[model samples]
Target: MNGVIAGISYRSLLGRRRIWLLVVLPLVLIGLAVLLRAVGNGSEATTVTLMEKFALGTMLPLLGLIAGTGVIAPEIDDGTIVHLLAKPISRPVIARTKFLVAASMLALFAAVPTFVAAYLLVNLESDIAYGFALGAGVGGVAYAAVFMLLGILTRHAVTIGIAYALIWEGVVGNFVPGARRFSIQQWAQTVADQVSSSPFLSTEITIGFAATALLLVTVGAVLWAGRRLRSFSLTGDE
Candidate 1:
């Protein structure tokens, strides 16, 4: 990946106050972890539940949406994307570079906070932290790629992304057992379940299946986004 393209992507994401917007979710997660632990009101079950529900589930997806869409959508909206696309760099490289930047931001804002929250909540069970940290890391990358593709495909990326995350992943996963197979949260929980030896932690999807699905989705979305970028039409073709 070109460092210049990566740098541009990073600045475009972080230079705006929008990056700070992502901080709210992680900070809330951490604050809840601390408050629960400090108040002596949290049990292992509560810790795991909070981490799975709020930290891993909510924060990871939210950060991914912001970083993923933030990197590319504004550029496309403001017509700055043509400037980048007009350069000598391959579209795939540009897409990959932006993916890396969004993934990195997710790691910092989403995954790291997940680790810290787990530590505060379930410090005795180190594997819980490790599991969710790895889970969040992988899940964040997947979410970034997916949301980035959505940005390329639609003007209302954030709205659609949130609906998918909360409605499809959260609600449907709870009600429809079959839907769990396709939910990113389940795939993430599968990764978490593998790393965490806790019997209480369970995933509907097998680790192998979830890992494979994640790989296919992340790689496929970025490649497709690259293709879209290659033939991107600002006049109306998007």
Candidate 2:
């Protein structure tokens, strides 16, 4: 919400070496879509599989980790966050600003590319493209909030986030019915299912559950991060 904080956060996030990581995933996603299209494998099933498995499952989490952590982690790690904390600005505003930066990064790097790739693979014949795109955008925001809280909570945000994304989301959520209720990916997929009439794109999670969970997680993580920031000590203790 604070423009100055948002500007500094943007520069901090984009100026880092991990910016390449942000660029790579989207490129790989679009490239995969192109390859599948060329091979005539752009069936609804294939499109849904790719979008669900690769785009929402893999790329969204990784991009979220990068953007979410990159916004504030490095500053915290290097002890430069003290400079910002010393400002008269409210701690919540700082947290919210960095969150907005991370969310915007997801919108650009995760959501937009998802739409483009889905469109490339399936076009407008069905709502799959729009469905997946919106799902990804909303999911990316939730991921950003969660991972941002993780960044504030620990220095190993990326490591823990990777494990959560790959193991919990990719493996467990897919196979375990109960676990799917807690998964951001599954909730997002449910959103996609509601939007797209394609039978290939569906989830065990209902739309009501998905909407409620997404809203709760996103808001809860952001508010928690703000509270943590408010009490954060310059010595790196909360």
Candidate 3:
């Protein structure tokens, strides 16, 4: 993708009021981490549980929803997509550019804070801080791709993404043992298990399976988004 499109995507991502929506969680997470540090509670078990529940379970998915759709949906809704579609660049490039911007923003907003929070809480084990950070980054990329595809496939991308992430993955997947097999949080947790020394951290799938699934889902979603964008209809709506 060209620099112009990438720049446009970046501005579209962080410039709007929607960017504020993305900011709240990271602020909360960092604030909570600070409070935990102030309280002198550095239990590794608590760190594992908190990171799993908040960073992976909640913030990552929500950030995914905002970042993924923020780059594309507003254009589609307001009819600006037509102009971009008429440009010389290929649809795949546009889609890839948007995905990269969204993924990068998600990493900045969610993943980096996760690592800093881990450090604040004195997580000095096997670089579990870095491990969870990497997992957060991976989840951001995967979720951004998937939700951007959903943005193209459905107008209610944010609603459906939230439902899948919060209700399905957060609630149902937690209660329904088999559902965890397909959850992104579970996959990320598997990656976290690799570089972390927290025994309490566990995942339903093996690291190999989780990594492969994460890769397939990310790549497949990006390809699907590009294909959809290639044939995206403007019609009289423009």
Residue pairs whose backbone atoms clash in candidate 1: none
- TM-score for each model: 0.96, 0.98, 0.96
Q: Which stretch of 10 consecutive residues in model 1 shows the poorest summed lDDT?
A: 229-238
Q: lDDT tens digits, residues 16-108, model 2?
A: 787899999999999999999999998989999999999999999999999999999988999989888988999988989989999999999
Report lDDT per candidate. 0.86, 0.92, 0.86
Candidate 2, run of 10 with poorest lDDT: 229-238
Error of 2 at 191 (Å): 0.5
User: Model 1 scores what on Cα lDDT?
Assistant: 0.86
Worst 10 residues of 3 by lDDT: 229-238
Per-residue error for 200 in candidate 2, Å, reads: 1.0
Residue 67, model 2: lDDT of 95
Output the TM-score of candidate 2: 0.98
Query: How many clashing residue pairs appear in each of the predictions shown?
Result: 0, 0, 0
Q: Candidate 3 — which pairs collide?
A: none
Top candidate by TM-score: 2
List runs of model 3 lying over 4 Å from the truth.
236-238
Model 1, 40-124: lDDT tens digits are 9667788779878887777888888999999898888788887777778888998898898888999999889898888887784
Q: Which prediction has the highest lDDT against the true structure?
A: 2
